[model samples]
Target: MSALEERNRRVLVIDDNVEIHRYLREILEGGAEDAEFDAMDAALFGTGAGPIAMRFDVTSVYRGEDGIEAARRAREEGAPFSLAFVDVRMPAGIDGVETLERIWGEDPEMQAVICTAHAEVSWNRILARLGAPQRFLVLKKPFDAVEVRQMACALTEKWLQEANLRQGEARTRAMLIAVPDAMLRVSTEGRCEDLRAVGAPQLELDDMLPGQAAVAAREAVASVLAGGPTEVFEVEREDLGRLYEARVARAGEGDALLLLRDVTDRRRAELAAAQRQLHEETIAAQAEMMLALSTPLLPIHEDVVVMPLVGALDSRRVEKVREVLIQGVADRGVSIAILDMTGVPSLDAELVDEIVATARAIRLLGAESVLTGLGSGVARTLVEQGADLGGIRIHRDLGAGVAYALRARGGRAARS
Candidate 1:
């Protein structure tokens, strides 16, 4: 077992006289050797009448310095002495009071008994040096063996209880450090009782919950104390420019526990994501409107539609043009789609490809595509780029395209 586990019954006796040391040892440890006498006593007077079996591990030291050294060593080894018996006068060394002071300085939990035959130092002087009468007992040189044993047992038990209490407080402090939220224990009247901070240490819980926040927390805590549900509220810190969520719950005895979590970062991320989505949607709607305006589809004649293209056709606008033409032709059920590019200033290979692709898409939907308003500059560029029209009908202007559509419709009517 560890030293601490076995330290409960340990005791120390400090005296220069060998006979005194021998007497204390016999009194403290002699009980175990008196088993035979105990049995006779038990047989004479029933088993209940026998002395209680008690044993203690006692260490004997010769001088005041030796006693202090032993106590310091025991403390460093984590098995400190529960009690010490020191003689008041030690020849050529310090006395009982000095020895006890030095030992207590190292191990404050150790209880001591000052042994003296004559009054070498006044009791008031000892008390003045020690500063407390709680841990020390004065015993005359002719001390009672039973009284010594009783003191040993009682003081050791007190030391163990104090050790246990210290351990419990240490564990509680560790648990508080492990929690991530800032916590405060508040009464129903909104008084802050206790505060603990784990992650958000800058939050001063000692400061009364501020302004409207104080009123909100007080109401919430009062409701909880009255058997209401736990309440949560959001409060913004204007100084820090952040947000926190406070959760208030009943902690019994008219007190409530307030747990605060900083949610500023999460809220900011959500807001930024929403703003980004809104911007993208707004741009998309504006682009759709511009596409419709740029490619205006007008039904100028029966069975024929005219699309007047007006902007320089970048790749994006080219895709827009293709979408408008394909959708317009299918929806209107027009037989001929006349694309009037009179306002288009120039042409490139990529633009020629886009125009051809639009015509192909319209033809697939069972509509014939007609090209008109081709200026000489654009016509020459198309020829130079080796652009292929693939049998798509062409006209010089909108009027010719419409006349062709009417004639074609009339011919089909006659045939039918």
Candidate 2:
């Protein structure tokens, strides 16, 4: 414990009788080592370690007005009493109820006990005058020494607990003020009261946000204040060229806290990346379409169709060629399907086998397959790969292939 926290327990006594004050001082201060008092402390506070031995610094005032003045001075001097014992009837000045009221005005945290001898003092009236039971208790004037000690210990401990809690809250608020994000404390109705900002000093609530963003901010605040969960929303200010993310949460009764941070660079980087990704996807799609269009199937005669294959023939491209040739022959009932591979740059042994297989598929559809425009290297590769070309005819070029098909079909002329 700190030196200040370990200081003597401060108590105030307000009564017209001087004997009552002396008796209380003796009971509180002189009963430190009494076994009965130690037992009472253990029973109340659950401390089994012998006597607490707390010292008392008691202040006594005969009149209620003087008690009030003393209480006020104690508070101003940074030595406020933790508890006060007040007698109900003080004939020289304001009564106990009025004196406690004035003392509370000075130090609202001060715990009080109203002492009265008569049974007909109207506790209901006293309760009505003072607000609630958490801060004050009533004591019969012929004081039980044990009860007095118990009240003094319990009420003083309660006051200390409350003081620690308040200090924690103050420190928390001080830390919040140093945060980089702009913060606002607003009422349920969206009235901004306290604003703390490290960077954006001019940043404010809904007024600073534009269009639907302002409306969204107010709605978020209302939702948090209505006991809903915390809300997160984002808004962009084109005028400032900045985007901000805001979070709203309940602070106290009927109050909401709003915190905002600038996310402009992050938002712009995301948009730029998205645009780049979309552009790359669009170019890839166009390339695929162009590749499909590059290999075109043309029908020159009634029963003859020619496809000029181009590009480096991978497995995927060769499979596409097979699909187009077989489907076209089935649809047109062509007797001769010629595959002219003049534009193909290169081929492997596996690709050569794939080409032979394509020709076989066309023959199965009741059409004669003609292979043309094979360079010396591709033809050499076909021989080296040991490809089966049993049902297909090979021609040197497209013209020779077309001429041979026409002659087999009774020498038909070219279409106009």
Give per-model TM-scores. Answer: 0.63, 0.59
Q: For candidate 2, what's the RMSD? A: 9.2
Q: Any residue pairs clashing in model 1, and if so which?
A: none
The digit string of per-residue lDDT tens for model 1 on 209-282 reads 66888778878888999999999999888988989999999998878898888899999999999999999999
lDDT of 2 by residue, 1-416 (tens): 74434743799999999999999998777654566777887988788555465556889999999999999999999999999999999899799999999899999999998999989887798888998778999999799988898888888888888898888877876787777676787776656755543334333456666879868888888888778899999877788888899898999888888788888888889999999999999998987787677667899888789999876788877887888899899999899999998888678989998999999999899999999999877888988888888979999999899899988888674433
Model 1 global lDDT (CA atoms, 0 to 1): 0.81
The count of backbone overlaps in candidate 1 is 0
Q: Model 2 misses residue 344 by how many Å?
A: 2.2
Quote the lDDT for 34 in model 2: 67
CA displacement after TM-score superposition, residue 361 of candidate 1 (Å): 2.3
Q: Estimate every model's Cα lDDT from 0 to 1.
A: 0.81, 0.84
Residue runs of model 1 more than 4 Å from their true location after superposition: 1-181, 197-207, 226-229, 237-242, 252-254, 264-269, 345-351, 375-388, 397-403, 406-416
